[model samples]
Target: MSATQSYAHSRQQKLVVGFSQTPAPTTGLTRQEIRDLSLKGVKTRAASTAGSGRLHGKVAIITGAGPELAIGTGAARLFAREGAKHIYLLDYNPAPLSRLAEALREKYPNTKASPNPMRHSRSTVDQDGVLDLAVSALVDQAIQEEGHLDVFFANAGIIQRPPKRVGGGGDEIAEELRATGRNMGGIEDTEFMEVLRVNTLRWVEAGSNISYAFKSPIHARPWRAETLGIFGLSVFLGIKYASAAMAKTTSNKTKSVPGGSIILTASVAGLKANAGPIPYSASKAAVISLAQTTAYELAGSNIRVNAICPGLIETDMTRGAFEMARMAGKEGRMGVLNPLLRQGLGVEVAQMALFLASDDSSYVNGQALPVDGGLTASMPYIRPKL
Candidate 1:
């Protein structure tokens, strides 16, 4: 059988296996409840299904690859299973990054996985004297070592949530978040300069003033390149650096045209309002725009740029919400608002990333694809029983 047919068969087998493992929900539940139960029925599947080696011999970089439930970590494991040459994992925390790298090595010995911790010190230069070069530095390293870069999944991002505390007002919580200055913009003097620096970039003005702005590795750096090029957030920096690296003609593929896949992790919140906080929504909207504009800008470069906007996925970023629901005994109703009626697993998002990263999406470019369980496809309406 052809490779395509074999893959289809493998997928079918996996689907059958997944269904067999999950029994049908009991009747008498509402339509939405039934749908939710059906979705949640299937346990979290392994990252690799058929191990068809779709990414064989390709070098890929994935940021935000730390937590066990993070989207980047899942993609890293999946990419490695698919026979990637090497996977560079980056995250702000060193411990988790190291752990993930070690795990990948043990599972996929053939694939080289390196953990590069991107420390977010409040300065241009950190202890290692590396100039806050999160994505750019990594891109350069990959090119030097591999002679070419293939897939770059900019999956690093954060969402600021007000801490739950007794006797703390909204203003107090906001102030507390500002004091942390985790991403940028402090409480007083430091905050003003951070705001100015962020605004001077102009492209990310909306997020500059947000003290507790959602951030990623790319957002930690004020400027991506030495010449002060492409001023924006995490995914923006990823597009700028990754695209540049991908466009270069390396020694290994000197005669061939430069080509690669750049996948940005946006959010369904970016597609519409009432989905996320004001700052987060605005930042994600910018991410979607970047994917669109950059695809056109690099039209003939053979580098396909796309954004995957996930919805209600149970990743490290959204673990709190899931935990709250479970604590309230409403875990089963976590994602009932969506047509799918259940929260999506990180592996599900990884599957979408795999599609975009592989040659399967060679012709697909400059698009913002939603992987949100059909959440954005419909408006606010109750599901009626047949």
Candidate 2:
């Protein structure tokens, strides 16, 4: 069978194993016929179905790239599966980062995955150092490849720890403590400042990455698991303005404004209080606030800004800690917020992220959404007696 016929029969759902269709004459086909054929699920012989090319003409970037970099790995794969022309997987560390890019190449095929230019990488916890560099690098990548930046998924942060108690409004205190001069220079300052630097600032700069993408895939477990992505998760930052700006930037899809989207990953712990470090909670809360505010501010930019608040997402950062907690018999505590009564899946969250990144959400914006399933709002279905 010819490639065109093979793809067509499959696209028409006529065959389960193949999908190739003949192009109805290049310039002679009627618009309605083209639409009908497409609706009927016809594909040109040269179509890539795995990625489906949702991001076919767009660009994107993911940062921090710790083992959780797998989240980006999965998203890159999905973006390719959806047909993103240029999916940039960036990180500071080379080994794991390179591995992530290579792994993506294996799964996605033909997508360019590489270490982001050092000039744009925020290597240290202090984000301001490479803020402009990182932002410009992403912008440059998009312009050089597609002549425009479409979406920015700013997903990276630092200074994470076990949940802390909200004694006398601890989240407020954490935010207050983080605001101290310690961020740049504080006497006997704690790590909150550094956490503030990475989570908040880096997340903000990523919004500025302006490559293209969103929050759903990053926060949902089902999406993450199926797609092997974690794009759907809460971002770490306390600034609502950044998110709002992002929303505005991407939403202004006018003839003059460039089109794009922004997805901020926040934690569910922000929606609820926890007993760990105050800054972590506050940091997440800031991320949530940014999602809401960014949606409002950037609505005019044709840029959609949204926040994804996650709960107990087990990444390398938290896996060991959770396991340690498990070894110490903190199962009850660890399992407190999961709606299905289990740890959430990163890939599931990544799927929500992919939705936010694609054209599917062209009309959605300025929202602080949650993918915690019923967990964020669900009361414990089963009260376990210890």
Best of the candidates, lDDT: 1
Per-candidate total of colliding backbone pairs: 0, 87
| Per-candidate TM-score against the hidden true structure | 0.72, 0.60
Residue pairs that clash (backbone atoms under 3 angstroms), model 1: none
- Sequence-dependent TM-score of model 2: 0.60
Clashes of 2: 87
Query: What overall lDDT, based on C-alpha atoms, would model 2 receive against the true structure?
Result: 0.51
- Candidates in order have lDDT scores of 0.67, 0.51
Q: Write the per-residue lDDT of candidate 2 for residues 236-323, one digit (tens) a residue.
A: 2212212322322232342235557777666775677542345666767777776777566454556677767666555655555565
For candidate 2, the 10 contiguous residues with the lowest summed lDDT are: 121-130
Tens-place lDDT per residue, model 1, 60-177, is: 8887777888888889888988998888776667777778778888989988875543332111111111113655677777777677788988776555434344354544534543
